[model samples]
Target: MELGVNIWSFIDRILCWRQPCACCGAPGRALLCPGCLADLPRLDNPCRRCAEPLPAGATPLCPRCLGPRPPAFARVHALFAYAPPVDRLITGLKYHGRWEAARLLGSLLGEALAGADPLPDILVPVPLHPRRLRRRGYNQALELARHAAARAGLPLEAGRCRRVRHGPPQAGQDAAARRRAVRDAFAVDGRVDGLHVGLVDDVVTTAATVNELARVLRRAGAREVSVWCAARAGRTSGT
Candidate 1:
């Protein structure tokens, strides 16, 4: 089995060798060139609680997510820090209607979480309000979740939750402001009773949004919730 896996990996590498790097225009590179891959700002050392970046050899949890009134979600998992090229990737999918970008980002997150010790039973994409959905023509989170569910083989439940309130964007909001912005923002529409749910989103900043969703999910009978984002912004996002 090991030898067969290695052989297939070698063949895949050969096939990918001819594709251009996604971020850089480097020729004859795989999904990303080696340099871009190394510089991707991977959150390999994340807080066990919020998935925030931690110093090498530091404790498992971040100070912000440590205090009382802990998050409704069990934990967060992510693949990258929301930095330059990574930000570009997210924005491309979010604003430019780039479906391929969603495919790349979602597949990356899904594959990373595929080997998670305890995977969630269902994946739920954060919903967009009806007005925003009509304006944007699609829910970016759902787009991301579709590819993630396909890659990870996790069942996706899109209608379980809905955004009942459409407030101002959470961008540029501090933690307190974010908490306020998302207050009563979500409503549970379908049954999630006694299930472990993986909340899928494009990015996680202070986590105010997902935490609110988790809160609603729990009230709707979710056993546990965890966040899975393509990227995690730094402390500057009010983390």
Candidate 2:
């Protein structure tokens, strides 16, 4: 029965005309073509602390994050650098109204989490403020989390965290400025005692937002926290 369903789904996808890759009219599943996927600007080596792509042979932590570590326990994993095809993929999901991209990005995130040295107990996407949720109609992070959770077979805690404050977008902000903007922004919605939580996001920049969120979860009694993001900006490492 499942095989029959799978075959039907595959055929349906091949016949569907509405959902083709914008970059190349591929008949089946893909936001970007295989050729485009190969051309994506990948981060070779990112900072261990903040997951920012770094120059070749640079240290693990960027100077800023090293000076005063961000609030999380340790380590961040990013699938790609915030440039070119990756940047365009993220932009399409966030702004151009392409939600299906989350499925593709989420699958990669799930694979990365699976390879982590220590796996987390629960997956939590960074919460969107109520106002932003109303405007956007869907939380991209949450959508990504749902897809990743399905792929990884990890439990997803959608209601475990809440955004208490809504602020301007973090674009163009420096590290310190971004930290200040997101401070006290998140609160755990339920018990997290001794739970190892994996936080998901579409991108990580200064580590400010995730740091602030991890602090909240820790304060709520979480035992450990790690971050998983689809893209990282600014620094790099060989991992």
Candidate 3:
């Protein structure tokens, strides 16, 4: 089994080598070439809680998500600031079924989480409604979460939670409407009590979905819920 796995890995590497970079069409071992990778919009001095870009020397939590009442998740870990090439990669994998983009993005997310002191007990891909799951054939979040779990040496507990409600695509909804659509959309099944759970998703725009999911996990006695997404979209329409 080990030898067969190694052979397949070698073959996969060869195949990846032949394909051009998804961003700039550069020939390379990685999905995105170094030049395009460098050009990707990385979050700079972001608010620790929401991963939104903050003014220099601003507080850890953004004003919009901060208040007397604490937020659902502890913090968000995002690689990019949702723009240009990063957006293309997300859209490609999510809408166009580009598995290579998912793998590359997940690997980067794993690398970022590698140094976490107290790693999450399990990684949970945000669930998709049964209708959407059937239509899409596969959940992009699950694909990315599987790759990230392997890289981070963690277990993926995708079955622990489920989406019970189906709503319209969040892309066209404002923040308030998004919240309403996602309310009570998720339910935890298996043991999650007191466990540190990490919610994995591709992009976090208004964060309504993750917030609602986190609320469910917390009610089920989860110790902490941290969101991990490939990109964090800016608050404004165009940033």
- CA lDDT scores, all candidates in order: 0.85, 0.80, 0.86
Q: Model 1 residue 56 lDDT?
A: 88
Give the per-residue lDDT digits (tens) of candidate 2, residues 93-167: 887666667877988798877777778999999999999999998898998898788778899998899999887
What is the lDDT, from 0 to 100, of the residue 51 in candidate 3?
Answer: 84
lDDT of 3 by residue, 108-221 (tens): 878777767678889999999999999988899998998899889889998888999989888767878888999998889966889999999998877788889999999999
Q: Pick the candidate with the highest TM-score.
A: 3
Error of 2 at 196 (Å): 1.1
TM-score, cand. 3 vs. native: 0.93
Whole-model lDDT, model 2: 0.80
Q: Number of clashing pairs, model 3? A: 0
| Predicted candidate 1 versus true structure: per-residue lDDT over 43-76, tens digit per residue | 7678898997788898888777688888889998
- In angstroms, the error of model 2 at 133 is 0.4
* Superior candidate under lDDT, 2 versus 3: 3
Question: Can you list the residue pairs that collide in candidate 1?
Answer: none
Residue 227 error for model 1, in Å? 0.6
